[model samples]
Target: MKLEIVRSCIFGFLLVIVQYSLAQEKPNIILLYADDISARELPIYGSTVWSLPKGGDTSDRQYRAQTPVLDHLAEEGIYVKTAWAATICSPSRAMMMTGRYAHQHKWWHNSDKGKAPNKKGSWNLYDSAPYTLEDIAHKGGYATYWAGKTQMKISGFNFDEACFTPGEGSYNTPIATTDFRLETRKINGQKKIFNADTNQEATSYVQSGWYWKPHVQLLNHPKATGPLEWWPNNKAAKDTFGLNTFGPDVELEFIFDFMERKQQEKKPFFVYHTSHLGHDAMDFLNPESKSKWPGTPKISWDGKTYTRIQPNVTGDNGVYDTHGTITESGIHHHINYLDYQVWRYMNKLKEMGIANNTIFIFCADNGTSGYGKGSPVSQKGTHVPLIIYAPGMNMTKKGLQDILVNMSDMLPTIAEIASVKIPDSYEVNGESLLPFLTTDKPKHREWIYGYHKDMQIIRGDFVLKDGKNDWWDVSENPDDLISFKKIKDWRAVSEAHRKERDELNKVLPRFNLHATAHDAPKNGLEKPTPLQLIEDNK
Candidate 1:
């Protein structure tokens, strides 16, 4: 009897351990990060800015780009309404990776390292620590994949596999739909890019042939391994998937490769697809750059459905030329392509039977350049789309979540998904979204913030105030925002509005940076000389 009792106790303890481990298992996370996109550009956001007729500004028409995939995903899950990011790329991406604001991370602007002076040298934003959301997910037992733009210059982040566009190089190869001819050579232990075309050491090729006949490098990929070059040993590979090889399409191919390879592996995966899809630099790629931008694919619409282009281009080399005239507005086609890719991602997951288990997030770094990219006076620069789609997983409230979310929240949110407890030693500013996402009544942030150069902004429910504002409320009277009388005193506004402003103002000390180099404190962060920064980065 004693022996039987002891055996039963041992089995129970073992079963408990097994169940606990299973409970702690993390869900796969895929951050579908976009480049320059704005919240106002999407139909889902209901912004009337683009509704004005086009031609006066043809670029505005592209904002009408279709995104059925994202639309459906938002309809099925949560579409964050008032999400925020930095007015620029590096700072926003840094916040997402490190889960901290500019004050904490010191990535105040988009200048090359060592050029900017403030005692903080020019290093990649997240270069300080060896850990990040990538490290967190990997350490928590997840296979990681990072593809597309590697602007952060992040050394590793512990990714099991990483493929990136070397700065921005025209991947124009002698053959192949993809001109994957870029390679990396370690010099003094630091990875340096080598261009086969130049038979010598290469310089920054950010925009030589980035879009068509493109170039890319595969690092730590599973099937397509090479010695620091592109697929199949990096030497010019044959164009198996001839012609029409859009660089963005090739970028997505890498993403699909990651998903297809890892679907059944039991171990979850994290994908940081930082696509160059949203920003407006494609005009330089147009064959006729003088008079036209690359046209959008000739697509047809039937009320609620879209018929995408199906081009028939034979032979190899310059086959991308057969893609026909780019009919879509420059950025609009890019936006439409973004939506199309999202559709593809969704369908791929559904086919693999992991769509229900995966967590897919789509958001942009900042706003469209020349539109919202660097505008400190308007929220257009900071407001971005935030969509979360986890079919089988729980969300706070589906369809539309009109919460005020910050870019800084992404890291902790990933940490929450992994069920990995952040160490006490790490001083991260963002809070985990686990409770807010899983529960209905969990209160979201009462205030949101943004920083770029010397300009800082604090926002509440009805008012958005930059450091220079005289306390005017732009969001009130949504239908007639400019109708509200200017307030001369605190008592001029409603109790609710006044209380909201006061509550938001309490967090003023949180921002410790300036709006420009001149506005900074005596020993505060300083911008590098303009000419040097622009030349160095370019």
Candidate 2:
């Protein structure tokens, strides 16, 4: 009996040792998400804007903007020539967090009208979504930190530590209300301040807010105050110079600080850095300065000045001043700034000696504003930039994937990279890209779908827009102008799409609508709801 007991103890110890060894092999994940950048904007993706002459002589060559950092990343990492995300910010973010389609998350719009005004509620981050990648990372013995724009209503789930500003803003002047707080919860007989809410001021503007100099609140204790910390600090809060101190730069600083602290702890880390660099906010400066740089307009959000810039015009004048032209160049400048930030982030990774082991993935949340945001434009609305750089990954230097991948794929991909097994109870709409990322075999899907109050399906070079049985064959047509003209009977196309959509819908699991609904408790807030059941007229 004594000999048997000794053998059993030895086996148990060996098992624990093996598990620890396996756990140590997990890769650190860093998601560098850019907001509202289109794939066409990158120089590697064949954009004329990236090749434009420096110093701005308005000419044919001037149309292309400089993005050397992005171009370098493309050369060094695997670039997905075709990737997709939701057409807007909130929905795309929901899809990314849940690994589900827009229909599943039910965050079809930025703000749901169906949410009752009286019912103050937020999405439960833990319930159905499982623990997010951040949550999983924390559980897997890795430090998790989120830095940048966080729009999800759910207060907490997977982050061990986090710093975020409410809503989304431009890169130049970001008005942030930091309402981060620490909450102590007893778990496994230990008192821990695991959940944190950083209190900061909420921007008065929604869409167009300050990009450079703006008011910001710094929460001393983020984990405790919850939402109240976000309230503007009338006495302590101060307006900072935006032009001299850009928002992206500030975000990078925080990220580096977090990374250094984690490195000292000798723990692998996960950083979800959502960058606001690519998104454009109109240039709002003095009228004389604005006139000197014509074509720019001042746009505000929530009654606060955000962006002021004019639109880019094509024809008529021989005299071209790309540098002084605020309209088009302003937007390009934003893109250039984003590229510069990307370069800075890469350098930071290298300086820390964590570049090789860290899995750096850069992507955009959705399509650009003009061509992609609100409408279902092919390549414009769905196509986004995806690049992965990890020396430890043994990934190819340059490769293109033609697969129909979605933002939902990110959750699974990250989980797989970390060697964590996602719970079977959690239904994921995306498949892991590990196979394609590691091998030469291309993963292709028969059809990929994009939905936002309408259904857009892509199959073998053909796109079909579905709305009430109105099916339009938008194949071979890249722009909406041609597709819009080709469609005659909207009802027929919609019906076909609905039929096909219904069949494909079963791939996702059923969720408690009450739990998943944006305003589940139904307090009668009069907010716009997600996916209002369409009446079948046919």
Candidate 3:
């Protein structure tokens, strides 16, 4: 009997060891972040604005984009019903990258410099808190790769491998050396192309062509070719496949290649694909007299797959010989194309046999460009789409979760997965969402917070404290801002509503205490950073 007991104890110990080993194994994370897309734009999230016509056809132009790839992925995974992002691109990205809010990070607004009196001059938010997903993953023995659009610049964020365009240049940047750098402006009356590089500083704007002849720069790669300096070794490929080169296509190709290479080397990789889609800038819409939408290498989706036909663009530097794309303008087409790219990623993973081990997250920075990017009144400016698909984690459930998920939650989740120890001294405004990936459903945040410049918004279960200093009933919302109910007194609402409101009100002081931290006085109130009180046990 004693001998049998010893054997059973040994077996149990071995089982525990195996379980710990499996838990420690890191999974590859791929964050496919779209530009200027909102929760309302996705049909899965339910948007009547871009809903399909009664006949369910595309000719009417009102037909919503069919994102079967994302739709199916959401159906097979978990999606957050109430996901919060910052009002604009820079702050939203800062939250995601740093796992902290604007108050701590000091990225209160869009520009690179902080406008607050406490944090003044060219003091960028990222330099102070230099920790990012890249830093965490790199330290945790994982390769990190970032691609597509980077709207903001964060200091000390050096990824292991990256192919990305800096700030708003993804539209008309040249893709290859053979591609033209668009120097030819309208000389008197006629449009002309200066094939050679010119010394015109005015014509050379930071906003270069990112799509056709994409202006790109290489980082940590030897004998690499792209924006800054054209390498001699890449001249052959540039001449051959240069003219019809496309930006999105180039980024996607690099991502797939990175995945395959990682798989071959038996290494884990964290990929951040920040796509420049769902945004139709007026400048991009009418680059010239012709429609650039229906131009060049056209991407087609036949309900199942995507096919691209590279156009023979024969012209001088920036002037593409091709007129426009076959596809029309609007956010729908851009979203549809984004879906196709998602399909391509799924297939690439399957081919590499890493689909089972990969974790895919699809989200957008903010709402659509025109309607919601900088909207002040409601939570419309901050809400975004969030879908998580991780098969290796063995998640069986699909559909929406009502947990209050903040954009800052991304970093902690990644850090937890990488087995990196987030410092105990540092306080972040986010908690890990990894528990939800498993069958365990732990308690989440009671309220989420967002800051844009001096304006602050706090979201609760039934109430949304807007930047306008007004309280809103956001329950049962496809959020209509028409009805603005004023908070007269405690007797204005029912006991349950009052109870909820009181609970939410208790948290407001914590945020208000920091009102004086702004560089400039906001609404004439001096906001100071809140002091964190830690109680010690007797």
Candidate 4:
């Protein structure tokens, strides 16, 4: 009996030690999401769709535009060529944060009024029509911070800190008003900014609009208040310097600051820094030279007229300016700006002595503007860039990976990297990419699907469209620009995808019900909150 008791005690002690060790071994995650960036724009990806201006040459390889930072990251990390996201911002973000498809989130469109609702006739941030990754992180005891563009309406779940900069309606002018600076507030005698700032308030200066300097808001979180509160303009607030400060530069500064503070506390954290850099914005400083590109507008978003520049291309008609194309030089500059921001982020990590300990993930929400976003093109609007960097990882060169991955996969990937187990009750549509990252083995999905109004399925080289049941051999013509030889029968293809669609449909209940739930009240039934609906489904 004595011997048995001793053995039992030893086992119990060992169990406690192991549990404690695991609880302490969380990895820090930094997600850098660029806006409106297309796979075709990156020279590293072998595309010459756009070129740099003559005087703006920054590298010896003229064919290859400047992107030293992204190149370095690609060399140090694993580059995934087959990653995808929803075409637009809100839908893409919803899919990413919830680890579900657009059909599940019920956020197919940007506007909230069109979709289904919670029991309350309106969707509340706390209600889980879409449970966010930040919420999962918070529940798992990780501190979460959101910085930069936030287009989603739902709030709460998990975000210790949040900040947002309003996107430009038009991509013209260097200085438009923006939510760009940092303000400090006292929390328990320690100075801290509001965890999140929605850049809804208009600013006086155009540079402030650049998302880099002049105007910025700060908020404070005493505990985990559901609603974000901004710090008043008080003496305690201090303005961030904005001498030619770019938006990405301002964002990285705060990110580094947060990481260093967390490092000192020895606490693992998750930072989501969304960049508005690559998105089209007019450079007011350097007006397009008319001599090089005939009929090109000199100013982007000309404030004098409150319109975008008219491009020289046919069908442009100068009717509406979405920032006219000025020799494609503006696109190059925007990409270079994005590259500089990436360099800053990596350098900051190294500077703070947390380079190796941090797991850096870089991705975009959806495909590029012209080819993808808001369209069901052959390439699909979902395609985007995905890169992962871990100093501990043995990867040291740029590699092309054809493995199927999606925005929904990020939550699971992060969970694995942080060594946390995802709860089974929480429905997730992604598999961890940790396997591919750790092992060089090729990975492929049986079928990858993209959803908007039309659902697209990728099985081998064949793509099946959902509603129309249209079948197209996307493998032969990935761009979907080829003329059809005959009127193809879509029913056969749709039937072929029936089993996979059925599985995807099962995941749809939670989101579809949430979106349409607002109408349940008219049926004499009390509507459940989005969270309640999700919980009921579970």
Report the number of the highest-TM-score candidate: 3
lDDT of 3 by residue, 368-393 (tens): 66566776566767888899998876
**What CA root-mean-square deviation does each model show from the true structure?**
11.1, 14.7, 8.5, 12.9
Provide backbone clash counts, one per model: 21, 78, 30, 24
Return the lDDT, model 4, position 183: 31
TM-score of each: 0.77, 0.66, 0.78, 0.66
Model 4 ranges with Cα > 4 A deviation: 1-24, 50-65, 112-126, 129-131, 167-215, 221-245, 281-329, 394-398, 439-441, 454-470, 476-538
How accurate locally is residue 306 in candidate 4, as Cα lDDT from 0 to 100? 19
Candidate 1 residue-wise lDDT, 1-538, digit = tens: 7667556545643443343246644567889888877776677876545322121133254447667778888998888878889888987887788887776566776762222235544544544433477877765677888777766654545677776754323233343224334446678999776544343454433243345445567766655644344542434444343234455666777778777777666677899888877654433223224322244445655645556786434433222344554454455666777787777787788787778788899999887765667766547578899999987665547888867898888887776566555656667777765556665443568778887766677787766776456465655534211233445676666788787777777786657544332221334333322111111222
Q: Which ranges in model 2 have alpha carbons more than 4 Å from their true place?
A: 1-25, 47-61, 113-128, 166-210, 215-243, 286-329, 454-538
Residues 1-538, candidate 2, lDDT per residue (tens digit)? 7666556545543443344345555567888888877776665666433212122222254454466666666677778766778777877877777677654455665654224234445344343344466755655567877766776543545466554543323222223432121234456897544212222222212222223322232222233355324323334323533223334555666567778888888888888887665554422332113211112222222322123233232221122233433334344555666665666667777888877778888889876655465556544566678887776766533655545677788887766565556656556777777655554433435455555543433423333443233334543333322234345644655555455544544532333242355353443223222211011111
lDDT tens per residue, model 4, 173-192: 23333333223445689755
Descending-lDDT candidate ranking: 3, 1, 2, 4
Best by lDDT, which number? 3
Of candidates 4 and 2, the better by lDDT: 2
* lDDT accuracy of residue 526 in candidate 4: 38
Computed on alpha carbons, the lDDT of every model, listed in order, comes to: 0.63, 0.53, 0.64, 0.52
